[model samples]
Target: MSTTTTAVINLDVPGPTISRHVYGHFAEHLGRCIYGGFWVGEDSDIPNEGGIRLDVVEALRALSIPNLRWPGGCFADDYHWRDGVGPREDRPRMVNSHWGDVVEDNSFGTHEFMKLCELLGAEPYVNGNVGSGTVREMSEWVEYLTRGDDSPMASLRREHGQDEPWKVPFFGIGNEAWGCGGNMDAQHYASLARQYGTYVRNHGENQVYKIAAGANVDDYTWTETLMKALSCLGCSRTPNNFFQGLSLHYYTHTGPWEDKGDATSFTREEYYLTMKRAARIEELVRGHAAIMDCYDPERTVGLIVDEWGTWWNVEEGTNPGFLYQQNTLRDALVATVHFDVFHAFADRVAMANIAQTVNVLQAMILTDPDSGALVLTPTYHVFEMNTGHHDAQQLPVHLKGDLPTREVEGSALNLLSASASTKGDTALVSLSNLDAEGPRTVVLDLRGRAVSAFSARLLGASDIQAHNTPEVPDAVAPVLHTGIRTHALGLEVDLPAHSYVTVSLELAP
Candidate 1:
């Protein structure tokens, strides 16, 4: 029998309201991501804002990044906020034991990070040290940032130069409690979260968002323990508040950490497997939400996938710890699929940050500091292409037929993913064609919605391994699409194989 496949996208059914934080990026003090990639020192020829590279800032601004998470991934637990304050020379030089074992000068501290956020017009989501630090340490850190009074920490903040307190709303109690962030069980971490959260005071007009370290991928037991424990905390007659959001971390990679697949070159099987892992995020979010539902049926708690993206083997000759990998159409496809999934569960998944913003796993920006060359990766294109979904009301979509599914070990994942949004008189539809081989023509059923004009943009490559380099910058960028139009029934567009397409339509009068 000859095989035939098609995709049907319904623009009538919308998803949840997409959070602005979904467009967030992460900047950790690991590898060269901060020093070489972003920070170039104020004295250098490279234009900078308090030592942060201006070129890098402009590039991130183009992405309209909503928020930037800072100061550690695994390093957050080991960091002491005080060490990063005061004079640059007076600051202690500490060895980064988790990352490269290199000495860090503590130049880029809390002040520098908030300054960078301000320059980019992005919100700061600071992760606190809980594994090695005390409750006083975490509480004082919060006071130093948000407190604007004569308190000890606030006084210290003035003494440092900033007389006024910074506006830092999002604070993570800890990160990855199961691994580098203190080897503790869910119950242990939950108790630790409660203690740290109780002391994390919100001074001034800034509202604090306390995030608890949540489960890894598919670790349902952790979520179950967290929900049950936090529920008890919520039910406390003493009136105590513990957490505002639960943080989850997951990476989409085909092989083990040591043997992660190459970023630029891969066979069809590898591409298929990588996308399979990417699509699993939908299942992960749904499963985590199910646990949250059992405990908090009112949906008061938020699910924050704080760390996510494609993690693969490092580029040739690059330091493995540096996590420098080439971005390609494959990564672009991965981003589209993940974003669509997040939108589907937008009510529960409030925020998510791509892992290691620049010069790291599936990075949106890559820099050659020596040559002063800055390049946006394929993943960046995906973000720019789908920016319409940011803060847009989710429109419901209905698919009449079954979308093809890929089977893995007796499990299956839908081949096509889609989401829709409407703002003002314009309706936007973004879809991902996850099929590896032939193109799929999707009949976009608009459900009798008046459509005046329509246009589309597509990011795809002839081969799955196709990538853009400094020499060939436009290898896999988005092409301005003009194929589909609005009819009385709907619209029809042919989605190229392994492509992400965004269609914008003008509502008719």
Candidate 2:
């Protein structure tokens, strides 16, 4: 392979507006992500708030998580609201069947999840069961959570012990209807979405955001079908809206689910493929957004990428059905790059939640429930470091050189990824070098803005396989460097290979 290098000291491109929800995360009942990860039951010795672990709550609060999707990927479609309400002993118990086939006690229902969202100060985007649920079932769920008066569902909520409604505004019609949810075609699912969404009421103060199940990856036809169907509904001379947002799910993996690449060990080949998959999210969003444009020129409906993140084989000796994976510096770069790309298309991409928030897949925080110890993963650091990008205006940056590329299958991805935002007199630049080896010299020309000083916090590891364990917690943490000098036309910094760095520049007086 031939070596490649690129340099552009000062190039300007318009920054995209960043959405607050892009920093959102997901927690499903599928694994320890909920049972042992975020919720350990109030009776346990662990510190908790109404059964939710206090430590987990504090950690997530620190991330400023804006939204959290719950109940599941496939579990949502199988879920029945009635079974998760009323007395615990009376609440029905059903086999997860889709996940580990473990029996679910329905202890954590609508009330518990809404309360958890309140504690985290996040908007609760509940995935309503549509594939296997009747329209009345979903409509009652909306009424139960949002109705304030003595309506049938509101009476049931009061009878269940929670008198006040929980004001949940975002609702997903189903999850992955093309596969796990029901395996329905785009045209068929579109009609089903219209019927189910029609009855979801926005009771007082809550302007419900109903989201339809979207395409998996690059299935543009799904977006086309949804947008066309919704457009037809909008002009049907009816007084109701079918849906507000469309959802898409994508995971970065190298092989089939059964033979996914190792989480902690990989050759340069594997590293390249992972980043390549991560970079494809940009194209996926753009392609889907383009279809939405053709069918709905008014941009009436939004795009919600509610499920996305790395999906690898389970850790050694861990429950294979749990989908647990170790978090490494590679995961941090993936998070940073993915967030930057999402920010670039903020107008169309209204909200996105990482696949699993904790203890499963590419989690931000992991816990040792047995010991009650919490570990912040590399992905967590990336979120903490880039949190400044939340609600920040995306500033455009131009690049002129041919950077190195990582090849996968037959496609190649640029090794350098970057996003810039300016708030007040401070300009923040986030850059990621996805190459597996060798440092990349980045020439950031900040002549127009008059930068006085520059500093950065970088996250990298000696090897792509390096990860954080309970014993080696600092294996991959951000290293802060201060008092950087700027000379000539711009600033030049050596970005470590396979690293994510955030540079903050102070504007000259």
Candidate 3:
């Protein structure tokens, strides 16, 4: 039986404006995410502009990705910026010890990344090296990327070819200093952030929003330790001036870290377990936000969830360290619910980046190694559908009726998830049905505005394991949803099991 769930959206009373950066993407130097996925080299047969793949850029451009975080997750800690500048051939090669022990040719460096960001129209968020790098090295990098020609580092950049200084809107002190970035305690890492972030200077017009590494999962103390570091009792610096945002890293997966279940081949029970884990992000965000509230009640310091997404075991036969996983219909639902939470907490949560953009964990685009053929994953479709909500005013979604729920590990799991936002005269409503075997009837009680008409798009498949392959790229793509009807309060729609639907409401003036 299709359970009916009614969600009332108060358009009259809107909350914070959802920052478009909340839908940002991450591109680390892991697996083919950089080597073959994004940077295919200027010499390659793939249609590219200045070594960056044009197809991938075109696809992501449609999604209007606001910002792109780069260079490393863990790789940032060991990455030295100088080696990647100057002549491409003269640049030294180094082993990517953190990921696959493969050698990195240093072809895609600061200039290439900046050029790529220019092509994609995304603000660049550079993660500086701190794990094994010196403060001087990181400080020089900021000068090189943002200073005027008078600065020494900027002059060096001119010698390498880029005469104009690039604007760096976002910067990270380090990545996961608790583990891969460095094995330091929270207090120790917090001190380093103050020191490192202090020198991440604003050269002329380019100002960087420095993000400090915060907690791992449920480590509220990590946030507290960092917040405590902002003690300006004796100093001239205020808490807001110390660091603009604190970072959190979380990934959803089923089973132990050593034995995460397969991405596609999962049982009904495992699927439910995976959804239950994915749903815990709301709890995690709220936990960290509550801690932030205790310190900065004015909410000046933003919570940056820089690393997040589903981390499944690598596809069979793939390198274990590469962290490659197939993106499926299940992955789409995970992205859907995550956006809902991000929208709800738009005030506190400043920015977020999915684990990767291509050829990695819960990737948006997957490229074939041999053919260079690209396939847009189901997760990509969700981002494209939700693009309308970028920088839109968030509306409160209240569930008036009994929420469709299921028992997972002795806990009630919400089967229907949703978020809504308004931009100009139209409002975008994103909905997801998490049940793997059952459909849902959802009544959207839209208040505060009269809806003249509406159109919806649905993304789903016959099987939960449905994914887009190079040969069958459109297998799991979105189609115009015809299962919707208009009503006085709002609209009623039917959502399929394990599916994601987005409604575009044309609000009457």
* lDDT of candidate 3 over 40-136, digit per residue (tens): 9999999999989999999999999899999979999989999999999999999999999999999999999999999999999999998999899
* Candidate 2 similarity to native, TM-score: 0.93
- For model 3, the stretches where C-alpha displacement exceeds 4 angstroms are 231-240
Residue 373, model 2, lDDT: 80
Candidates' lDDT values, in order? 0.83, 0.82, 0.91
| lDDT tens digits by residue: candidate 1, 266-302 | 8887888888888889889999998887777667788
Q: Model 1 residue 20 lDDT?
A: 81
C-alpha RMSD by candidate, in order: 2.5, 2.8, 1.7
lDDT by residue (tens digit), candidate 2, 1-509: 32333333232343546888888888888878888988888798998988999888898888899999999889998999889888877988988878778898998888888889999999998989988998899999999999999999999999989988887879999899999899999999999999988988889888899999999899998888888776653353322378989998999988887797888888888888888888889989989998877666566567898888898888888777788888888888888878878877877888899988989899988888577788889999888888787887777665656577756778778888888776667778888888787777777766456776678888888888778877888898889854234546477666777888888877765
Q: Can you tell me which runs of candidate 2 are displaced by over 4 Å?
A: 1-16, 232-240, 482-484
- TM-score list, all predictions: 0.95, 0.93, 0.98
lDDT winner between candidates 2 and 3: 3
Q: Decide which is better by TM-score, 1 or 3.
A: 3
